[model samples]
Target: MTVVEVLFLLLGLVAAGSALLVVTTRTMVHAALWLVVTLGAVAGIFLLLAAEFVAWVQILIYVGAVVVLLLFALMLTKAPTGPQPDLDARRALPAVAVAGLVLAVLGTTVVAGFHGVELDLDGAVVGSAQTTGATIFQQWVLPFEVLSVLLLAALVGAIVLSRGTGRRGGE
Candidate 1:
């Protein structure tokens, strides 16, 4: 087994474990923290695939900004910070079975698709930053602007929701 394979295996395990924690944790804050870990591990996986720009963006956008905002909202709302109830083994068993089936199908599809493909790691890593920046601004500027607007809307919504309803027009 190669070093890359080992890294991938370890990172994948971390990502999966954190993702499960995110869903299973009772406390909202702990779930958000687990989500951050999962997002960071995904960023590491992107870096291992020689996608530094994407990895940094994942960390900056998802782990840094989104999760922070989510936590802030949770705090503002005074969400319950208690231990979770026990997982229903009956529901969990079916859910796990479905998840496993989906994973198997996706894995089979990816492996079959890339069975004969050869990727050049050096080329993938070289000059990627400049090209990625240019591509994002040039090709995806519209979507980028739209996402900014969406974020602004989300922030406004959070603020509006946090405000109490007992407000007067002239106070």
Candidate 2:
């Protein structure tokens, strides 16, 4: 394999490992931090694929903005810092089953969708900014909107929790 292939494989492994940690961690803060690592690894993989703009977008949008917002929400909510029994329990059997099911579905979809299509990585990308921007927005609109809603939900939850504490303390 080539050097780029090796780097890509390494980054994929890192991303996968951190993603597992993100789901399994008991602490909210640790999970958010692991999510940052996972997203950074994904951005590195994009860089290896010669998608510089996409990689930077991933870093700036996911690693910089989303994770920071998640961390802020966690802090504002004053979530429990101790080990969560519900999160830590039975991590092996159920987690493996769900992960396997997801992998099977995604793998089958990718194979069916791109059965004979070949990716030509050797060609230089020469698209204008408008074209690239439009493509990104078109393809990523769902995910971007979903994340926006999720972040907004977290912010609202934080506000609710903080108010509860304030009223309890008679502030």
Choose the strongest candidate by TM-score: 1
Off by over 4 Å in 2: 88-96, 109-118, 126-171
lDDT of 2 at 36: 94
Model 2: per-residue Cα lDDT over 100-159, one tens digit each? 999999999999999999666676573445657787689988888899999899999977
Off by over 4 Å in 1: 86-90, 116-118, 126-129, 146-171
Q: Residue 9 deviation, candidate 2, in Å?
A: 0.2
Alpha-carbon local distance difference test for all models: 0.85, 0.84
Candidate 2 backbone overlaps, count: 0
| Predicted structure 2, TM vs. truth | 0.66
How close is every model to the real structure, measured as TM-score?
0.73, 0.66
Compose the digit string of candidate 1's lDDT tens values, residues 77-130. Answer: 887777647533546878888989999999999999999886556556532679
